[model samples]
Target chain A: MGGSFTVNHLIYLLQGMMWTVVLSALAFALGGVAGFGVMLMRTARTRLLRQISFVYVQLIQGTPLLIVLFVVYFGLGVVGIELPPLLAAGVSLMVYSSAFLGEIWRGCVEAVPRTQWEASECLALTRWQTLVDVILPQAARIATPPTVGFLVQVMKSTSLASVVGFVELTRAAQVVNNSLFTPFLVFGIAGVLYFALCYPLSRWSRSLERKLNVGRRQAA
Target chain B: MKYNFDFASLQEYWPEFLRGALMTLEMTVIACVFGLVIGVLCAIGRRGKRKWLATLCGAYVEIVRNTPYLIQIFFIFFGLASAGLKLPIFAAAVLTMVFNVGAYTAEIVRAGMDTIHPGQIEAAEALGLSTPQIYWDVILRPSLERVYPSLSGQFVLMMLSSSVTSQISAEELTGVANSVQSESFRSFETFIVVAVLYFGMAMMLKFAFHLFGQAIFPRRRRLGTPL
Candidate 1:
């Protein structure tokens, strides 16, 4: 009865796909907030803050996301706080994404010409005011392309969450494949679904990068 | 409210851990060497005059870039098994990393290649250099030199991603950590040790690449900066 691929399996996979999107959105949102703080700390005036965040980023970036997932999942359990799979996966993804996104945004912020920062200072602007009025607007434009690009990475990486018992797209594929015994057909369909989700974002990121380059040239 | 950590019981597994780390490093080195070769060829194919070859390379890049590597590994490992042509887990893992890193390296190499001035190629042609000679001397060397930093970074990421091969139980560092943790019931401690090992490995690789860069790119070493 379970040997054939069926519409029921497709429907289940579609449902799992929805969870994948939700997890990606959740991770991105949470990581964005934390990563902004990290970016600020890394670029902050205080040497201590900068050093702390620098080490944090290096440590997180060095380790595999899979290990991070296991650490979050089982570490919490060790502390007698058992979380559901989704929460554990989300927390780990947030940690992973924050390190990467923070680094990306730091680059974007630093790309704002040094002259602009000095000019803002010369105008007697406070650091916050300078960041808000003079620096962030410029950095935001540079950040958009990479941020969108990183979203594709995030979406694809959510597949790793399947390992921690989260029934996302990849996990769902595994489940179906277990029943149907068709690795090629099942995983191929899963891969196609992921491509459908990610391809547009990749194209958009490329186009944005091209447009940004063109805009810089025209300005020059 | 309180949990005591015990690493004493895990000390006996040090040899296994060391072996696993060695295996991980071995896989990364093999994949990086082969992947770079494949990547350079694909990058060349992408820019060649043949439409079909370019398109084929383009599709390979896009498909690999867009899909998750986990599924790619599963497709190869399990799909082959289902076909009754089962490969060893180590071979399958290395093949998957090569395929995944190859696409990424092709892109990076292509970007480097794009920055080579068209006039430089024309100059080489004017000097009566053959296509292979021009490619080797005027195109590939400088392009690789320019992209060395990115290539090294990708290779390190490839090393870390190799942890996923543990899913197929390839007995890499992460796989060893998984089993050791389960055996000792000390999951947190085991992962902490493994995480530190990974960090150490990543830093060592970065240092090694920096030194290798100095050795190869004498021009950059003289300037004291990357291109």
Candidate 2:
């Protein structure tokens, strides 16, 4: 508490923030691909597939991401497999994000008009082809806002990785606090950094949602 | 590689586990109840015709919404200590939770309120309803009925996020697990058991919220659909 904040500490925090961004991108990219599969399954013709995928979403959504991080980080070791915390944390985050992203994407896809599906059916397109050619383009527009919003959630959630001893931003703040004994200052700065990362995305998501609603109204 | 796993060590800790589970539920329900009240009030405050008041409420919502709950907990638990108001960890945890969820609930409730038509308020006024009566009958009740699902979901999430309070050693389910794991040297097993418990608790909360919604919004149950 005696010494002022130094460039060294700021650099450490910045490096930690970089990992935060990298982990977020990793989670989003991997989760995006996985969620796409989940979205397909959720709306698949097979009732069982939809039910199973729905269960998947519910199971993942119900549990806290912190617990998921713990299970992956520690449970894997119980089976005599040792992995780096980064890999485990990243995988868990990806899995967790996929379920939520899947749900969001499903909503967006469903929001696309039934007429579009009928039109594709009249054109003799297969369900897969109809989804790919007709429905997805419209769903993509509707999906952007929630997707961005989910990214903020993903970023904030990655802080849970700290509990599993992953040295991300939150963990870095904790480490610095231990040294400086400045709980308020250290965590406050960390919180502000998180706010910096999330606030713009939140604003963008809200604006996109509003704009999309306006577009839907104009089209109507 | 061959590995031996034993959940037996954790099984004996079930009493503690039950107590912890109950604590988690208590914290969540209490926070949800109080937070909902705060949220509705703030939402109403935001809708009030005062520019500065609205701006202040807006800022509160934005700040609380943006920051992580972990930070908010620290700000409450530790921040108040520096200000010479030393509160217990449980109280601090609940307060932080109330403060956190209140803002979120405010925004969601505000969205619900926004959907109420002007005609309804006009009708209430035309009936010579007092301001409080109109607010109660026309605005708040219908608005809450509309957003009941979202509010219930948020409450369930608050229950799940309550696990993070264990970081500050509030003696909740996860905190109990942390202690049991350290004592039993069964970190992985302890966490797995606790994770299952959390999953179970979440399911229970979902069911409870559904029941509560049905009880509160009987019309919804009768109509079998949202308005």
Candidate 3:
């Protein structure tokens, strides 16, 4: 009834923003490491390995992130692990992000072209060296735009962590709204903050995409 | 680790589960239909003669695409309530989904539209096709046929994202799962069931879209080939 929108509310939101950044960084770092293994497994010479990795991607890409969060948060408790909400959310996001990043990097590797693989083989380079020296560097350039775009998805998805009681931006807004009953002002500012964080990345992604298209056209 | 998992407590909640699943399906279908219309219109808006219309549509797409669905839902559900324009929860959820998916569909549809060769439109005109006739027979139908796979993929994603509506307590599958889990204290089991149900729903959606594509584009169906 009294003034629900106050300076204190804004500060609380800023604190929530910090957690959003922290969670995003954590998921990226962990997901990146795991995704590397998945990417390698996907491209390895063995059909069995590639098949397994493909199944992993399908399983993840088929399901919702919210279910993954719930499974990790609640499923772990059933197994006698009473972890904090942050830890649970982190683990779930890492798993979720890994599947997507794996698929993305797989495309990047395959896009390096068959000729590059054969040429590297002609050099008598070992499988590891060829991939490490030649394939990855080329794939990296192609990967930049999609990878950056996926980061936007990662950041937006941190909102899901709030469902597990991890107090990030969206959750903070919900909390403030409960107290203030001024849902519009509270949620609108939260949405604007999310837009502020995401809009630049979206622009960068589109620009990168355009530049890459130009590069491809010139090559053609 | 020793474990005992039971789904028995959730068994009696079948009615709620079914109701929620139907609601989820309804929400998805409603959103997908309206979203596709909005998307195609926006795609045309972006490509047609007016610069301002293109800019306006571009802004709408970017704003919706950049933000999270949860935030969008909150804005429509809670933001509108504060403005004293409260709709029913289901309507609010559907409206949010329509807005959210419309932007994404616009981008995809625009990509489809881009793949239309300039020669095709000219050929249609050469045949004495009216502007509306040319747009329908030449531009829209073929472009949609070419991008049907991507459009279907987007719809699957939309159905998956519909799970977020549970946050607003809209009686969807996830919302029902939440209630059942709390009542049964079988949180893990309940989620596992809901997850599997969602996977099933996704497959069903894909199959339905495939059939729909076949029925709508009978030429492609007769050829047994996608556009």
Candidate 4:
């Protein structure tokens, strides 16, 4: 049966791992930008904008990412916009992560005290100026750990692309196991590689949470 | 670019959809109960005096938390089957969910336990409660009550994420969608309708957990507030 898993299979899995990282970076970058806009809309002055953003978040968050992938991958095909597996996965992951990241960053922004905004306004700064120059900087500090933490979620999520025929680590393992009938070895290696990729990010997130002494605001 | 959506044809598949939805709910219910039991035990183990027990529980949490559910399912369904510990497909999928959710619940429960003030424990100690009694009355009860909101939310999330169990060909909502799409060749309509069904089921799970929470936590009913 094609002799057991060989060095070539390991190499292929490594290649798949590379693509997993690429897709994760792509999703996080695109999602982060879109998430910023969502955060702004969520924390906007107008109640309508905040409500609209809330609904968008709820809709995306409520649906499983698998359904999101299916809708993006196949639903767009119905409209004559066919996307390749990588692009489809990338787009869907971006949609999923943007909702989560937006909610996370919104919490960070809301964590900033009301006095800072008022103080900035008293200093004659416009609302946009205060947001850009004052508020966001503070929120960015609090957002670091969770943002890095969500990166692990982004990486694990890239595995779903395999369902759409994108040969990431999980898909590579599946192909190898199909031929060699050694699901344990193949999938075990893939799981360990994912753990290696995610574990450090998780540790960093935890350490950041410890380091960010929020006592200044915790008491507030 | 003229695509027609024949959801009307799906009228005949209504039974399939309902069956699929109910199956998903069943798995979620089973997973939630077993997972929380495992989670609570692990949480207590991590905080207990046994050195190796805490380490083993810690390792379990880290491994499950770090790995993706997709791989975890593949490992259990196929990997363990290859190792001759074969299980039914539904059992394998739900087992994987219990394992995965148990780790997450352990973390959340641990956090909730940490939030209990030391003063509260001292007060309980002064009342002469034994160790087991202290754990049940002073520690686990209040920590669980404190984290009920997040715990219930996690169960709701487990319902949504359980869609992955369809990979093992479990007759859950997503698996039903797969078969229906193949039969109807109305892939777009099939997926869109199934997605809406999933969203609806997610809401249903959340609401059900909410009501269940209200019923179980009597203090909440009396105080009209979280513990």
lDDT of 2 by residue, B1-227 (tens): 66677898777899999999999999998999999999998998899899999999999999998888887887677768866889889999999999999999999999988888898889889999998898888899888888888898899899989999988889999889888988998988888788889888889988988988888878783322443
TM-scores (chain A) of the candidates: 0.98, 0.96, 0.96, 0.96
The predicted structure with the larger TM-score, 2 or 3, is: 2
TM-score of 3: 0.94
Model-by-model DockQ, in order:
0.88, 0.66, 0.70, 0.80
The lDDT for every candidate, in the order shown, is 0.93, 0.88, 0.89, 0.90
Q: Candidate 2 or 3, higher lDDT? A: 3
User: How well does each candidate superpose onto the true structure, as a TM-score?
Assistant: 0.98, 0.95, 0.94, 0.96
Model 2 stretches astray by more than 4 angstroms: B221-227
DockQ score for model 1? 0.88
Candidate 2: count of backbone clashes, pairs at least 3 residues apart or interchain: 0
Residue-level lDDT tens digits of model 3 in B1-227:
78888878788988988898899999999999999999999999999899999999999998888788998998889888888998999999999999999999999889888878888888888989998898777889888887888899999999889999999898899999999888889999999989888888988889999999889977663321433
| Selected candidate, larger TM-score, 2 vs 4 | 4
Q: CA lDDT of A188 in candidate 1? A: 95
After superposing the true interface residues, what Cα RMSD does each candidate give?
Answer: 0.7, 1.6, 1.1, 1.0
Best by TM-score: 1
Candidate 3 lDDT over A1-220, as tens digits, reads 5565989999999889889889989998999999999999999889999999988877777778999899999999999999898889889889888999998999999998899989999999999999999999999989999999999999999999889899999899889988888877888899888888888998899899899989999999
Candidate order by decreasing lDDT = 1, 4, 3, 2
- Model 3 spans > 4 angstroms off: B122-128, B218-227
Predicted structure with the largest DockQ when compared to the true one: 1
Give the better candidate number (3 or 4) by DockQ.
4
C-alpha lDDT (0 to 100) for residue A136 of candidate 1 = 94
Candidate ordering by DockQ (highest first): 1, 4, 3, 2
Q: Model 4: per-residue lDDT, tens digit, A142-182?
A: 99999999999999989999999999999998998899988
